[model samples]
Target: MRGITLALDAMGGDFGPDVIVPAALQALRYYPQLELLLVGKPAAITNYLVKYNSISNDRISIVPTKYIINSEAKPSQAILSSQGTSMRVALELIKVGRAHACVSAGNTGALMGLAKLVLTPIAGIHRPALMVILPHQNNGKTVVLDIGANIKCNAMMLVQFAIIGEVIAKQIIGVVNVPRVALLNIGAENTKGFGNIHQAAKILSNISSINYIGYLEANELLTGKTDIIVCEGFVGNVTLKTMEGVIRFFLSLIKSSDDSVQHNFSMNTNIVCNFSYMNPDKYNGAYLVGLCGTVIKSHGAANQQAFTTAITQAVKAVERQISKKIASRLAECWITTE
Candidate 1:
């Protein structure tokens, strides 16, 4: 909460400067010590800052960068072929010590790709995986790892996800000791799954990396007992989408409810009713774990609130020293080159 200056991609996101400018102003109120170096068009950014008479111009500096990285743009082309995009510039800020963290509501694939290429990974990391928190049916929330980083993984990779998931749970979710973990599968029993999952269970069991609670069906994600769920991106993406669709279905029901039904039904009826109303992009931001610096990805179509939360998420990541914790956990397993 001291003096943490964040580098934000002003032209990123669907709404462009319209969403980014206002959200930056909103974050200032919550984080008084927050300093922003807007990375995008100068004329537009200056005009937006001029609207706020209470804030000084120097605090809202603009770092010029041309071109916006579209959601449709290939991740490789944006990261490798072009260097003028705001997303790449933000990461460069972290690399050169100009900023502490980078937050972008840009292309998820480009963000993930650039994070690995620019920020690089810790000494012992092979690749970075994406993780996010979802509300559980029992109460609190559950951590889902490998949202869509890698579609295919080996037994060792899945086991790594379990250990990585456990570390994230301890840091962000505040689950101390060993958190109960489950592998996403067709059934609960160990005999139900195949490929990396079956092999993963054995690897996880022997490594003693986390509190393995065995396999969990998609329905069990928010069931409360499990603290973390690990699986490949193909399965994880499907599960996430299904949960999103379910949330949308209930939201429509709530909106269309008649006065008679409204009188009979309380607003607090469903457990995750409020959370369920959230947009997929709003609750869909993921952190690329195993990186040297804090790298977070929000949906390209994200709204203002989600963009602000991504900044808050970045703050927590840096303050908690998540990179250090992950490094420690990785070193315990893999041999360090540095």
Candidate 2:
């Protein structure tokens, strides 16, 4: 645990080192075992680091990189021209084992591409999925995957997502027994979703190791009826963004209402606060699960608190050895990369 190190792309986010440097120092206070490798232009990162000086300077180090991938950059552009970017340099540190994991709030597509290029995929993984824990009504968090990585997936890929999702639920979320896994469909009926999802359901049911609970629809997502939900990237991404929009819209409405309305339903104020807790920022770190090394993607516009949460997630992934656990589970399932 003492050797746990995480490489962070300080220059990647919307706020750049100004926000990231403070967040990194804040995270170091909470995670005693954590060390940070801040990747960016030396002077820019150093100025902030010095200003928000950590209690233990020894836990923090800098790896100066030469360029940045624009927020709008495509994966092809990043692959061709941004080799020296902070995101690439941070991931390279993980590839070489200089760090156990890497966290970035850069261009999502670019980070995903660079991560795959540098770290490769886990032996049985076809492609990595972006996964995060969302607060469920049952006071537990549900693991959702493929939030925006691979737009489309086959039955086998959905099964692979299940395996990764299950491992995460058990290892990180601390589910005591078999986690109830389900495929997210348009409806819960057997014939409701696409052929690939139907195929995935059949595969899940027959696998004795997985506590497959059949199909779950989007409406039941936050009910905590399922421990893990597997869906293709396009669907998952849309669902996630929709939830964010709804929450924001309601919060805005509540705040703008007249004083009479605000006073009559003051209890709703508490609910509003809870909704704030449920914001995506609190769960800001999403792993590109299925990568050979641990790589977390944070929201590019995340504030200091949100960025701190992402750093905490990266440390947890390293501490739990998530990548190793997933590889072992895949082997047990007799899933092969070839």
Candidate 3:
């Protein structure tokens, strides 16, 4: 595969270009086959680049943009009025085929809205959904989707999500054989969730290609029982946040327990290392799946390390030809979207 070029919205996150530039430098140093286009005020990004002592002039360049989409900006405002924002500019680079992928630690709604408008969806896809990788049992991982893309979805949309999720697991997650797929529901029975999930399940079961494994409850999400979990944005977002909160709570509680100083220190360190798998920073980038081009949305509050991981995710997705693969799969399935 050819080298991957990624565009970044340098001023999108809470820390702005100061944090983004360093991360870009780190990614460049790590992946010799990667190049970056930093979209923000040229002077600001240059200052950070020099401060970080990153003089890899050949691998990194800057694209200046005057406006920035603030965290509080609405999706409609971003889509209709914020043409000059760094986030929009980064995406435009991909829309015009100047970059292989774009990564931004920006407002999710604004990112999603602008991405659909600028990059558009895959031919038969109605809307793109945000998907994140989660640590599964036995040091494995799983892909969960619609973490906050479309709050309301019909049965067909859910089925479409399954297809996108399956493609991701196969290509990006490196699932060797068929990935076991399941729909997230209140219970493991066929009669749980709403009618839409039931309908989606029926559709999945009839499809001979995927290893459809029926319903999965929230508790079994990280148990590695299934490789992909599908749900509407509202439920998936709740499930994701709840898991993050719970993991942090347990880690904190484990550290505070009364014990000998040496033992406590050792145990705390081990727990922190082991539970690092649950850290959202490790999986900071969530892809807006089913788009015509690659677009990754990092958490708005992502730190430098987290944002760098997001950039890495974008590079890997581009290398895997995720967008092209998803389009080919969808065309083969021939699911009509109007």
Candidate 4:
């Protein structure tokens, strides 16, 4: 594999360098051809590097920045004051071709704003969408989009998400057949959702390139019945978080059970193992797709392993030239509501 370099926001997440530095080192060990630019306060980052005994590692370099974006800052506030922040610097690296991709566990609003300002969206795309590959019951995966990028979307925007999700399912997830596309709604009936949802469904149904399977409820999300599930940011974000919470709650039940109960559960090891796959840690990275460059958003509260998973996600996107592929695919089958 060719060498790929990624820029990381060392001061972005809840634990900052405490989790990022170790994750960086772990990624470096896993991907021999990977190089990293750690953008943050030098002293803080170097402290972790020294503790990890990788201060002299050749594949890693530090790009100093003084400011840090607060997690609660608004997107407009962040953009206006983003000049010297670690997240902004990391994204700028991608804009200037200093790195192939960027990964940040920072404020989602700020990251989305800065990435669009720095890299620009693909031609014909109004806005980029946050996308993630979710595991399903069939041991397969589903492509979900607009997790938190846009709070509300119109018919056109939802249709665009369907097209983008389809391309992702085919290009990134390697879906063999025409990927099944569906709108996430309150019910499976045609008249079940809002007008925008109905309009988007009508549009998708007409697009020959998309295999629109109509509406899918929240309960069917992990059934592996559909390949792509499209919805506006607010709905998608809430659904993703809800699923994570439920999985954690179930896992907690098993772990906190009595000795006798634990023994009974242990007898059904396969059931416990299956629940492990539902852990949110395994799906920590969400791609800010539709940009000219690759940007991955890790969960702000992610641990070392979860952040490392985000880094590896960036690496895979860089290696696959995901942005370029999506752009080409969109140009070939561009659809408009006009």
Model 1 C-alpha RMSD vs. true structure (Å) is: 3.1
lDDT measured at residue 305 in model 3 versus the true structure, 0 to 100: 93
lDDT of 1 by residue, 179-226 (tens): 888888999776787777999887667655557888888877777778
Q: Which tens-of-lDDT digit does each residue in 1-338 have in candidate 4? A: 14999999999989999999999999999999999999999999999999999999999999999999998898899899999999999999988889999999999999999999999999888889999999999988999988999999998888878888887788777899999999999998888989999999988877777789989999999999899999999999999999999999987876666344655765556667887878898889999999999999999999999999999989888888888888876765654323
Q: Estimate each model's TM-score.
A: 0.90, 0.94, 0.95, 0.95
Q: Candidate 2, 317: how far from true, in Å? A: 0.7
TM-score of 3: 0.95
Which scores better on lDDT, 1 or 4? 4
Highest lDDT model number: 4
Worst 10 residues of 4 by lDDT: 329-338
The ten-residue window of minimal lDDT in model 1 covers 268-277
Count of backbone clashes, every candidate in sequence:
1, 0, 0, 0
For model 1, the local distance difference test gives 0.77
